[model samples]
Target: MRSILAVFKREVALYFRSPIAYAIPFALTLFFGLLFNDTVTRNNQNAPADVIMTFIPGLFTFLLFLIAPLLTMRLLAEETREGTLEILMTLPMKEWHFIVGKFLAAWLYYTVLLALTLVYAGILWRIGVPDAGIAFGAYFGAWLYGGAVLAMTLIWSAVTEDQIVAAFLGAATILVLWLADIAAAWFANLSNTGEQNSVVAEVIRELGLRAHYTFTMAQGIIRAEDILYFIFMMIAGLFITTRIVEVRRWRS
Candidate 1:
């Protein structure tokens, strides 16, 4: 636990010291700020809560498609690229400690990024009443969803030594997940009117990111399965990352 905390602190310090950290958050805040402004301007007649519930959660979900890769691409890839992993492996800690520490660090940073966006929520609150439960659920869902995305990106990072390659592959993997909903629809179209078509469609949609958010968390309908899926993804990513580190340690 101490070793993991040390790694977490080190990572947090590194993020603050780097330009990429500031740049990413600034870009996100700016983009979302503009989005919120546009939403307010366009829907002047709609209730604030309605607009927020309808759009912000979906927008945050889309934002995760980009955020996950950017935040995690360097977690392990940079360590390998710079020859630091070898030196780090010489330390007494186990593989899971390092992997969890780093993953948690990145997840915390993402939470901070999400926190910065709360200004929009504040604005909505001040100007008009918003549903507390819905807003809270949306943010909670976004964080969990982003965690899963980040975990997968971390896996991609572990697979490559180059940060750019890691980022590219991570982004590509996320894009595939994002498009899974479209693929599901396309497959359903190919199938004729039968039980098989619906089954196939249902299966594919279940795998995609949107359906999960749209039907459950974003709607303030938090189910055990929906929450568990993201938790499972995070655990799987960290576990696989530990394995990768073990392999690399052995090879080196």
Candidate 2:
């Protein structure tokens, strides 16, 4: 526990000192600020009941596909590239503790990114009545989604010393998971029966991260299965990353 906190503090300090960390929040705020302005301008007459709903989907896509990769690309990749992994492994801490510490640091950073968008929700509340339940669910869902993505990206970061390769693999994995439902729908359509419940389609849809998030949390319906799916992803991702780091530790 002490070792984990030590690593966590170290990573958090590093994040603050890194230019990319500052740049991500700055860019996200600027882009979303423009989007909020445009939304208000277009819906001048009637304030949208839930302005959050209008852009939550887009936010999910942007964060998952673009931001997540950049955030995690250098976590372990840069360490390995600079041969710091050897020094880290020489420490007395367990491999899982190191992985968990790093994961928590990245998760906290992602949470801050999510929190920054809450200003939009507060503004919507002042202008119009937004559904608090829906907003809460969306943000909670996004938090879990981001954690899962970060965990997966961390695995890729452990696999390669090249940050670009890590980022590419992470983004590619997310893209495939995001588009799984669409591919499933296409498969159902090609079957020529217009059946949405084909076995293959159902299986594919179940495999999609978007399906789990969109149907449940995004709709203000919290389901155990959906929550479990994300938890499973996080656990499995971290488990794999631990194993990879263990192997590297042995080699060093």
Candidate 3:
């Protein structure tokens, strides 16, 4: 427990101290602003707070693919590159401790980034206060969504020693997931009433990150299943990360 806290503290501090955190968040905010502004300005020209809130969470989904890799690309790869991982392995702490702690730190960093986006709420407030229930749901959904993305990228970090390789793998994997969502949408829209095709609909729905993000969050309906799905994904990814680190240690 003590060792985990030590690692967590160190990693949390490193993220704040390093320029990587700022660089990624700034890029994300820039992209998000462009998208949200375009939607609000064009579709609902001179819209109210509730309408903008509806648009922001959906637009926020795009950043998951672009910025999530930044959180995990350095986790184990940097240690391996610097030869620090070997020394850490020789210490009293086990692999899972390091893995979970680092994962938590990264998770917290991403979660904070999501929270900072509440400034969007403030912006909305300047126009008019939106529905509190819907805004809360949207924020909650975005938080879990970010958690799942960070966990996915952490898996890439555990296996690869090169940061570039890790980042590429992370981004490519995310891109595939995004593409799967699009394919599912196409399939889902094929049938009349979007039903009568159970197999196709089920497969497509399962692959949809945006389905959960848009309906559950932006629509202000919190679903237990979606939240649990993200929790399961995050835990599964980190567990695999621990296993990979353990195997790497055993090999040496």
Q: What C-alpha lDDT values do all the predictions have?
A: 0.82, 0.84, 0.80
Per-residue lDDT over 166-207 for candidate 1, one digit per residue giving the tens place of the 0 to 100 score: 888888887787787788888788835577887887887877
Which residue runs does candidate 3 get wrong by more than 4 Å?
27-48, 185-197
lDDT at residue 104 of model 1 (Cα atoms): 85
Task: Please give the lDDT score for candidate 3.
Answer: 0.80
lDDT of 3 by residue, 69-89 (tens): 878899999998888998999
| Model 1 ranges with Cα > 4 A deviation | 193-197
Q: What does candidate 2's lDDT look like per residue over 49-76, in tens digits? A: 5645536544754467777888788889
Give each model a TM-score: 0.93, 0.93, 0.86
What local lDDT score does residue 224 receive in model 2, on the 0 to 100 scale? 88
The better-scoring model by TM-score among 2 and 3 is 2
Instruction: Quote the lDDT for 162 in model 2.
Output: 94
